[model samples]
Target: MLDQQITRSIRKMIEAREERVRNGDANGYGVDFFGMLLQSPVNSNISLQDIVDECKTFYFAGHVSSSALLTWTVVLLAMHPEWQERARKEVIQVLGSDTPSFDGLAQLKIVR
Candidate 1:
């Protein structure tokens, strides 16, 4: 029952996002992730289902890595609150008012 509800919700979310992408509402984000994927030269011949299947693969792969990193971070933070504050301070000092982003991440030598 819960699985069906989750599936339906995800279907609706994807449909809404697809509608937004088709209508060019994705321009708000500057570089639309999904729009770029769908229009990519390498993916041009692939069907929508192929795109979806590839997405599922990436989602599951990322989920594991992200969850593990988050779990370990939380555990370490709980064990060392002092270190947590220092890490947060360093991150803020390096990022310095700019939002955390992929482009910004590349510039953070201390972080990378």
Candidate 2:
């Protein structure tokens, strides 16, 4: 639903950025958040999923008033060290050291 819409929007944005680079107009988007996110350092191997995740994070975080929720989550996790350890183990088991993808996240039952 909403998630798909956001993914599609981010994909379109990425495509536009790639097209600009292809046309030698890389600076057309200027030095904004989106531009910064799209550019990688030399030899960086940022995948399309990585860019999409960044965009999704930025979009959702920007639209939400989540400070309280975040603080409570941190406090709860801090109060439950065993839960933290379990979540850590689950994440490691599911993703190893790789950046989490949507499917990988779904497989992390304990963390979820």
Best by TM-score: 2
Report residue 74 deviation for candidate 2 (angstroms).
1.1
Local distance difference test values of all predictions, in order: 0.62, 0.76
TM-score of each: 0.47, 0.49
Instruction: Identify the runs in model 1 with alpha carbons over 4 angstroms from their true place.
Output: 1-27, 30-57, 109-112
Stretches of candidate 2 off by over 4 Å are 1-12, 20-62
The residue pairs in collision within model 1 are none
lDDT string for model 2 (46-70, tens) is: 7778879987886678556567667
Mind sharing the TM-score for model 1? 0.47
